[model samples]
Target: MEKKIFENLSKICKTINYIDDESDIIKYSKDWRRRVNEKALCVVFPKNENEISKILKFCFDNELKVIPQGGNTNLVASASPSKEKEEIIINLEKMNQIHHIDTINKCVVVDSGVVVDDLNSNLEKKDFLFPLEMASTGSSQVGGVISTNAGGINVLHYGSVRNNLLALDVVLSNGEILRLGSKVGKDNTGYNLKDLFCGSEGTLGIITKATLKIYPKSQNYFTFMASFENLKNIINFYEFISQQIRFPITGFEMIPQISFDLCIKHKFMKKSFFQETKNYYALVKIQLHHLDEAIIDLLEEKLSECSNLYSEIIIAQNEKQNKEFWKFREDLTEAQKLEGKLIGFDVSIPLDKLDYFFTEGKKYIDDILKDIKFHTFGHLGDCNIHYNLIEPDNLKNNFYDYEIKIKHVVNKLIKNVTGSISAEHGIGLLKRDDFLKTKKNLEIELMRSIKRVMDPKGILNQNKIFRN
Candidate 1:
């Protein structure tokens, strides 16, 4: 049976490459999750749509499953294969191509596997911006971005990946092509299928291509790093900023002092932006287009009157300094990784309930474990923060062994605050059971029904987004 399956795969993916080597097999076996190991029988690369269709048909006929992968940067282990080894990995990197950028329509039609940073630069050169900027933009692919409906720095203004995607070209589980939505905005169809597949995380179908909406480049953008004595003060400043300006307030990131120290210990920064006097801080962006300095005056006035902000760092005496400030925030993630192995989660809660979630959640773990440290920071604008628990300092220690127990405590805390297990990272295996715990039985049944209607034979990314 194995020999016959490989033979059929070779025929369908003739123009592309196939790797059955030991190292190659191991590379595709897991994602960044590293919590569980999943091995794929063979990894197949298809160059185009026709080749993908043929490969899917072959897998369907043989009663095999295919996990579609791009960049392999998923945090929730969504792209990683199951332990069954009954699946073949389908990588979309070969299809990375931007076919057309229609400036008049304010959209770009691109092949699935294009990198986000590459797309961003391409659009910027043409005086348009894709506006989806994440830490993994250099490695994360368009197909995965669209499938996961990724949210990043600019989500406060442009919204998540789902809001930017105008259309999608998908391949269903039964080897059928689906073209939903279009470059045009208004689509009051029978059902909004594009939205459905945007966050489906490849369980429903494989997104091969997409038409994404772009915005005109912002004329003026400024970044500020403000220090607060506590998380409560940080929340107050957020409320103040939300009410003050109506223009594009692109990003508002909250960084606790612990996470900040982690960055510094790893040599992420040399001369600090502000004096390290407070336990908490916020990195904010205010985008404007005008000749008046009134907005800046108003912002400064608020900072002064609030009595919460300990200090504020406005780097840009000129435009050059502002750009430098932006670069510092973007590079923060890379700097953290240079230090040690990290375990983190993407979580969300109500904006007003932020204080309880962070304070109570941290207290719960810190009380139990005295030696370990947990770092918390993320998009305060959209209410999604990354709660990372760093491994113990000892090199020989195994940090991942405590994942299940730690996650259980955090999940319980989030549930108490009416929050979700996942905010941006989709329900890959890492959080599949957690997601199910939060949803009702009927909701799970509905999702299953949708899967059944779309992929009757259960060939596309089987045993993902749900329990087997």
Candidate 2:
């Protein structure tokens, strides 16, 4: 049956695009986290929208499952395959292309497979930026970012992928093309279909191309790193700066001492920079079109007001220092891998409850799990925390035994605070059950109804977003 299906796919897709080698299948089967690994029958790379349409049409007609993958950098297992080995992976790397960039309209139309950093590099030459950035920008693709509705440091200023997205060209389940939204913006014609698919996680359709909003590059940026003795002080400082400073704050990130220590231990950064580390740290960046004496004076006044709240404050005087501060945050993920087994959580709560959530969540984990360390950090401006659990050296090999209990303890506490279990990270195979547990019955039913309407045969990204 697998051989016959491959033959049919070959007729619609190019021979070079069809890949069934075990090595290639193994590479594309797992996600970035390596949490789930499922073998695939084959991986197909379609070069154009027409090819993708034909492939989807064939899969729908044959009742074969298709997992549309871009970059394969998803933290969740959304882009990974299933355990049955019946699904075929549709890799979109070959379809990468920047169709056009309209500076006057402030939008860029490009193929789905374009890397986030590559697009930003092109836009930088024109003094423009896409504004949706994350740690995985170097490896993540535009389509996957849109599908996941990714949020990053700048979300406090520019918002998530959904905000920057102006339009999308998607291939539906039955090979039908859907052009949603508009390049000119401000369209109230009918139901907003673009939003329905923006974070749909490929359950509704496959995004082939997109029109994204861009903004003029900021001419001046003020970056600073401050250390606090406690999380409450950091929270207080965040609220104070947010209210007092009138300039555009582009980045506001929180990094705990443990995360910083891990990075330093792994040699991701020099320890001499952080001469005296505090309990927690906050990184802030403000972007402006122009910087004047008045702007500088106002920023200085604001920082002085919260001087007592922070123990140490270091402002980036040049571009090199600014990049070094950001490197501290971006290297946290890779640094954690150097430690033992890691279980990471991407969740969001009310802005005011940021300190409380971390305090209580850490306490809950400490009580249940022994010799476990917590490395918590995220976009504190938006209340999203990447609360991760790391196994101790003695218990490194036995971390899996406590995975379920740890998740339960953490998720239950988050629920108590009325927080979302899955924030920017979509409810891929990793968190499907957790999502169902947290969401209301009506909400789940509505989602299922929409899924049925868009994919009746259940061939597109099967068993994702929701459970069977």
Candidate 3:
């Protein structure tokens, strides 16, 4: 069966584009987390939508499971293959192309394989910006980001990929193509199908192209880091800043002391802003067409009023300094790897309940676990935090023994606060069971119905979002 499928795939794709070697299959088998060790029968790269349609039609006819992949940077094992090795990986890296940029519409039409950073670079020349920002922008492709509905530091202002996405061109399970939404902003047409595929994680269909909204590049940026004595103070200051800052604030993030320590220990950053670290730190960024004395004075006055809340503050003087401050926030995930084995949770709570969730969640973990360290940070403007646990040196080898219990305690706390277990990261293989348990029965049924309607054969990204 596998031989016949490969033979047909070869007839459609070029020789160089079809790969079945163990080395190549292994390369595209695992995700960024390196946790799953699943291999594929073969990997094929389609150059255009017509080729993708043909491949899907073949897979549908044969009832072969297919895994649609882009950039392979998913942390939740969404793009990884199954351990049974029954699936074929459809990689979209070769289909990268910027089809058109309509300045009049303030949107860019692009192929799914276009890297986020590369698109931003191209837009920079024309003074336009694709506002979907993520730490993995360098390796994350447009289709992958859209499928996952990625959110980052800029989500506070520009929103996530779902917000920036205006239209989509998707290839469904039966090889039929769907062009959803439109280039124009206003269209009260039928069901908003574009959103169904935005965060679908390749379960319902494969996103082949997209039209995304763009914004004019900011003329000036003000980046600063502020230290708070406690989490409450940090929350209070954020509310105050959100109310006072007249200009558009592009980014807002919170970093706990443990994350800073890990960065320093790993040599990710050399300079430390404070002589003594505080309980929490907030990174704020504001965008403006011009910076003047009045705006500076108003900002200082606002900070003076909140002096009791913050212990110290430092604003970037130049672009280099701005990047330096951001490096501290962006390098955290990698820095934690140098410490020990880690378990991470991407969650979101109401803005007002942010401090309560952290305070209670930390206490719950501390009560049950011994010798476990916590490194917490994320987009505070939006209420998402990457609450992570680091395994101690003595228990590094045995961390998996306590994985289920820890997740249960943490997820219980999240549910208590009415928060989502998976925020920016989609429910890939990692959180599928948790999602099934936590989500309402009707909601789950609706999702299952949609999945069945789109992929009746259950051949598109099988065993994802739900177990087969």
Candidate 4:
């Protein structure tokens, strides 16, 4: 059956490229999540919209499941296939091409496989900002970013991947090409389909290309790192500064002291941002292009008002220092990788309730496992907190063994604080159940209805988003 499907796919997508070996399938089967590995019957790389449409039609006609994958940087196991090994994997890497760059419209059409950082660099040459900055930007593809609606540091001002996206060229389940949305700002046309594909996680359709909105690059930025005696103070400072900074405040992040300590222990940074350790730290970036001396004085006055709340403040006086401060934030994921093992989480709570969430969450976890250490930090302004558990100190056991049990506890705690289980990370296979816990029955039914209507045969990414 698999051989027949592969032969059909090859005939349909002649433009597509492939290395059809079990070894190649083995290499592409798993995602970064690594929670589970499922073999793909075959892997095919589509080169263009026509190739994608033909492949989809072939799969639909053959009654075969097709899993479309981009960079595979997803923390959730969304891109991986089910255990059956009956699905054909459609990789978009070969389809990478910048379709169009319209400076007049301030939009760019890019293939789904273009890396986020590479896209940013391309746009930077023309003094435009893509505005999505993820730690995995170096490897994460544009299609995956749009599919999962990935959000990052700049979301506070620019909004999520969905906001920056203007239009999408998607290959629907029936192999029909869909051109949803337009570059024009205001389009009150019927249903907003662009948003539906933004975070669909490939259960709906394969987004072949995206027309993204670009912003005029801000010329000046004020980046600062401030250390606080308590995590609550950082939270408090966020509430304080939001009222003062009329211009866009790009980033509001909370970095725990142990995370910084781990960086030093691993020598992640030559000179730490702080000379002395504190309970929590924050990295805030304020965009200031038109502000003059008087406005700068007012900004300083506001900082001084919030200064008493924090113990130490390290302002980025030069562009070099600014880069260093951001590098510290950007490299945090890699720094955490240096730790023995991590139970990764991307949870969210009300911005006002973060202090309660942390205080109660830490207390509960500490009581359950006395030696447990947490490296909690993320976009504080957006309320998306990534609470990661480092390996317990002096433990000689396998950390991955406790994943399921820890997730239950973490999910319960997040629910208690009115938080979402999976914040920016979509419910691939890993957290699909948790996503159910956070959503209402009607919402789930609506999502299921859409899935059913679009994928009547249940062939596209089977058993994802909706549990069967």
Candidate 1 lDDT over residue span 1-468, tens digit each = 777777878887632212446567777776875655767878888888878888887777777888899999888888877765677889898888999999999999998989988888899898898989887889999999888889988898889998898999998877889999998999787999888899888888889999999888876766677788777778878887788657678999887777556666777666566755677778887888863588677666766676544555553666776665566666666665655667677899787887787777777776655556666788988989888777767646566766667787888888888877788988887778888887779999999999889878887776678876
lDDT of 2 by residue, 1-468 (tens): 777788887887753222446766878887888878777778888899999999999889988898999999888899888665878888899888999989999999999999999999999999999998788999899999999999988999999999888899999889999988889779888898989888899999999999999999886999999989998898899889989888888889988888877887899976735669688899999986687778777898889988999998888888989888888788988899888688889999887777677778778778777667888888989988888888877864577777788788777887888989877999889888788888899999999999999899999898898875
Query: How does candidate 2 fare on TM-score?
Result: 0.97
The candidate scoring highest on lDDT is 3
| Candidate 4: C-alpha lDDT | 0.83
User: What's every prediction's RMSD, in angstroms?
Assistant: 2.3, 1.6, 1.6, 2.1
Regions more than 4 Å wrong, model 1:
14-20, 291-299, 318-320, 338-341, 395-397
Q: Tell me the deviation in Å of residue 298 in model 2.
A: 2.6
Please, what is the whole-model Cα lDDT of each candidate in the order they appear?
Answer: 0.79, 0.86, 0.87, 0.83
Query: lDDT by residue for model 4 over 1-468, one digit each (tens)?
Result: 555665777776532212456667777778785666778777888788898888888778878788889988888878888765777788899888887778899999999999988887888899997899878999899999988989999999999998888999888888999888888988997889889888999999999989999888888887889999986788889888999789789888888887777777778786677878788999999998785778777888899987889988888888999898888887777788777677888988887777777787777777656677788889989999999987886787887777777777788877777888877998888788778876889999999999888888888887778875
Instruction: Name the lDDT value of residue 156 in candidate 3.
Output: 88
User: How well does model 1 score by local distance difference test?
Assistant: 0.79
**Using Cα atoms with residue i matched to residue i, what is each candidate's TM-score against the true structure?**
0.93, 0.97, 0.97, 0.95
RMSD of 3: 1.6
